[model samples]
Target: MYRANEPIDGGQNQNAATVPGVVARPRAIRDHLTPILDDLNPGIVAPEIQAAHFELKPVMFNMLNSIGQFGGSPHEDARQHIHAFLEVCDSFRQQGAHEDVLKLKLFPYSLRD
Candidate 1:
């Protein structure tokens, strides 16, 4: 049986010099793989998203808040609340703000705890 620390070929194990028990990848292979591994990493943000410009105006928040919080109230009309919200969103959309920014960021602020 061969031990992990013991050289298999008369003290000529190729990896023994670099690491006691671990093998080191060749420099060429490591260099070639680095860029591919970086691209595959999810934490890296795309250039487009990083360059995107999203401006949030206080008036937009006021408009959404004016529509009132829809907290599943039995007395409140959910459809009417939704219609008002969409109407406010449309007004902002016509004014050059992205719909996704309005929905994702400001919509949460419109909700009540």
Candidate 2:
């Protein structure tokens, strides 16, 4: 009943669904990741990309919750919002906005560890 862009925890009708958010939870994502991963752009494959992508889900959820409540920075609560924003940018690539994709691809790294 929810579109991918719509906030899952937004204050419409909380009781209507036990599950919430852009992507579903661990169980559902785990079960479906293989096929979905197969279909996705291959560059997404980092060592812990899936976990990095979804494990911080509480960040996105909390962002939605906070934004719906009042004026705020959804990002202030969690750095995961950075990744969430990245996901949104990537999604927009299908519509031909490639500079962000290129920038994401070309991010510089520090040699120091």
Candidate 3:
């Protein structure tokens, strides 16, 4: 369609948007947190201060194992996985493409390949 003084309608007259190069999206835990802890080391600087040293990792072993063990408690594992998965999705939605959030909901676990 065209007006008296207007040009004829042509959908091909428009230019397409330029897309940027393939980008590596920032991962919250891997990119940000790991850099901070990359050079970190655990050591006691004060031996005379009478400070209590407890290994938190080994201490939580029983509780952590009880969550995912077969016939132990499947509910806890599901909750933890759901929470972790949603946290990653939320992080992506905040910084990365929101469309990627849809893919986050689909974790590939159905095949060994």
TM-score of each: 0.47, 0.20, 0.22
lDDT of each: 0.65, 0.39, 0.36
| lDDT by residue for model 2 (45-83), tens | 333222222222344444444433222355453345445
Order of models, best lDDT first: 1, 2, 3
Over the stretch 1-113, how does candidate 3's per-residue lDDT look in tens digits?
33332223333434423234433232456566545666778652322322243222332333334333233253445556555544533433222324343333233321122
**Per-residue C-alpha lDDT of model 1 across residues 27-111, encoded as one tens digit per residue:** 5666766666644757533232232466777898899888898887789887897788778877875234446556656666666
| Ranking of all predicted structures according to TM-score, beginning with the best and ending with the worst | 1, 3, 2
The TM-score of candidate 3 is: 0.22
Candidate with best lDDT: 1
Better of 1 and 2 by TM-score: 1
The predictions' CA RMSDs to the true structure, in order, are 11.5, 20.4, 19.5
Winning candidate number (TM-score):
1
What TM-score number comes out for model 1?
Answer: 0.47
lDDT of 3: 0.36
